[model samples]
Target: MPTLHELPGLAGQRLGPTQWREMTQERVNAFADVTEDHNYIHVDPERAKASPFGRTIAHGYLGVALLAPISQQLLAVEDATGVNYGMDRLRFPAPLPVGERFRGTAEVAEVTEIKGGMQVKVTLEIEVDGQERPALVADCLFRYYA
Candidate 1:
């Protein structure tokens, strides 16, 4: 992993592609339970099978949920203290269908060193199955401190 200092200079640079295991129905159902989003499109495979995408489709938020593991793979930070400062301009343009292999690209957008920590903002572009339209786009903010 590149050092945090190296990251600032890489602003607007697309990080390497980091993939996640295919989003599964079981996982989706689990998220629905956790988030209380039991929408048929996301939970009912039989019903979702009749939708435009066909088969159970993943929840839009689920796309965002994939960020942590993917980001962990991209940034090898040697620190234990990191906090999510929040996100900006998050959008889910397309649905990620179940069983599709997904990946994310993180581009450094901005960084600022504050009294408490370093504020890092990254534009996360997540996609599935090499599709032209990204499944999700989010400007994520995170803070890290030694």
Candidate 2:
């Protein structure tokens, strides 16, 4: 992990395509249950089988939510506490079909000074294993306090 002070110097640094994680039906169902987003394409396998994707798909927001844990593996400030600031941009270029494997990668896009902290913008991508397009791509912001 890099310290908060080192953030500015690490701009443009590319981080890991972390360990693959499977998108299971159980996981999707849990996310749907919590978010009250039980969309048929996400929770109904039989109905989803008739959709273009051929099976249930994970919600796009689920991929966004995953950035929390995924970013931990990619970037961390050893002596600072980090909080999500917001996202400048987000896109789901490909559907994340349940049962598919995915992983995350990040790049330090920018860093700027702020009161008692540094604001960092990271470009994160959640890629489906063996797929040509990423399931999620976002410019995520964070505030790291010393």
Q: CA lDDT of each candidate?
A: 0.79, 0.95
* Tens-digit lDDT track of model 1 for 100-122: 88888888788787675577888
TM-score of each: 0.89, 0.98
Candidate number of the best TM-score = 2
Give the C-alpha miss distance for residue 48 in model 2, angstroms. 0.7
Measure candidate 1: CA RMSD. 1.8
Candidate 2 residues lying further than 4 Å off, grouped into runs, are none
Model 1 poorest ten-residue lDDT run? 74-83
Q: Which stretches of candidate 1 lie over 4 Å from their true place?
A: none
lDDT of 2 at 8: 96
Question: Candidate 2 on 33-96: residue-level lDDT in tens?
Answer: 9999999999999999999999999999999999999998888899999999999999999999
Q: Which candidate's lDDT is highest?
A: 2
